[model samples]
Target: MSGSEDLLELAVETAREAGRMLVDKRPVDGPDVVQTKSSPTDVVTQMDRAAERLIVERIRAARPDDAFLGEEGGTSAGVSGVRWVIDPIDGTVNYLYDLPDWAVSIAAEVDGVAVAGVVEMPRRGETCTALRGGGALLRSATGARDLQVNAAVPLGQALVATGFGYAAERRARQAEVLTGVLPRVRDIRRGGSCCVDMCSLAAGRVDAYYERGVQAWDVAAGSLIVEEAGGLVGGLHGAPAGPEITIAAGPGTFEALHDLLAPLDPARD
Candidate 1:
């Protein structure tokens, strides 16, 4: 069986390759839309599928027995304990618009627990990676550096990062929830990508992050990055971070945001 570091190495290599492919083949006019899901604003692009295929094929060649859960491709079962959770393009809308906030996120889960993860932002020219117990690191053109979340920031002074759902109803409820969250914090940033926001939190670019209606593929890699960076990533009322809602922040900031968000019931769509 492969070790955690081995999985992390594969994730990093695959993510970097996928990021390169997406960037190189990107059309000057933008990518072609494959279709939309859940809502019209929730889109899938041809590059999304190509990236997922490339990632899965590359990893499967090295670890054929492993499973997969991809955002573009659905779940595929395997006998091996390792299962890859991937978001080929975490911010398709941003990518479609030629924005730089999109990312290629991949996480290797052993027996349902993510042991290693990578979130590669090609446009930003940075990659974030973490192993089970290993600390998170950010790699860029200049060099690489270990990542750490901001110190225990009070909720009132926290600069929170977040994203909205694609559906109109969910967006409406999220906006309502934000009305409560906006005034309580120092300010808010809607970054358009969950993995980017989580990585931003890990790199101390943002004090905290919270979002509703995110899938496992969205947070699987980024959450591990945050936790490994000496932060907390979870749901409200002691739940694990998942689709209902996911929040991440440093020590005091996590609890403060959690307590503040619990009453708002941001989970409701």
Candidate 2:
């Protein structure tokens, strides 16, 4: 963690570069290219590829021996212990719709642990960065400031944010789960970007967040930011977070929120 600041800088730089590429290529109505992945709802566009290529190109140029994993592209092995995990465009649908919630996320992991993370929302002109031990910070045209979640907020009054997977079955299950969760909390917001949701929690914009079937690149950086911002993160049923499910919140609401969602755990679905 102490040695992670440099890596954090690198991640921030990479995210900024990738974010600019996405903004420059912002689709006018719709992007030039669009492709389906596992389903019709899950789509990718030329901007995703272009941004990922730009990000990978920058990281590969700087750290040739470092491994890389990206949402648009697959994995690239390297000798360096540092592995750069990336999401060129975190909210593809948002980007496609020209929504302001999309972002570029990048994280640096050493020995399978995230040491530094960065998320950039180009349209919002917002950047969130964090190192393993260092604190989380959010930057905008206004200025930069340290990030801290509103841990004192009670679970009942907390504003929760979440996202559903693209699969129809998964969406259906998540909807049912939300039906139960909505009445228990203040309200729920369906933000399109995972990084944005996590960073928003870090900035005290949201009280809690959880999602199932999140890709590694989706939460990698954002989780670190949450942790550094005095928040807790865990997977479904106290398991380590992965592609299954992830829940993040301040210490006060973590357990209570987790307990409430345990019955609806997507891992069980």
- Which candidate has the highest lDDT of all? 1
lDDT of 2 by residue, 1-269 (tens): 35587788777888888788777767667886568986898999988888888888887887789999999874799898989999999999999988899999999999999989999998999999988888999999999999998885777899999998888888888888899899899999898999999999999999999998888999999999999999999986669877777899999798888888887765645
- Distance from true location, Cα of 20 in model 2, Å: 1.4
TM-score of 2: 0.96
Q: Report the C-alpha lDDT of model 1 over 11-38, residue by residue, as the tens digit.
A: 9999999999999999989999989999
Please give the lDDT score at residue 46 for candidate 1: 94
Model 1 weakest lDDT span, ten residues long? 71-80
Query: Each candidate: what lDDT?
Result: 0.94, 0.88
TM-score of each: 0.98, 0.96
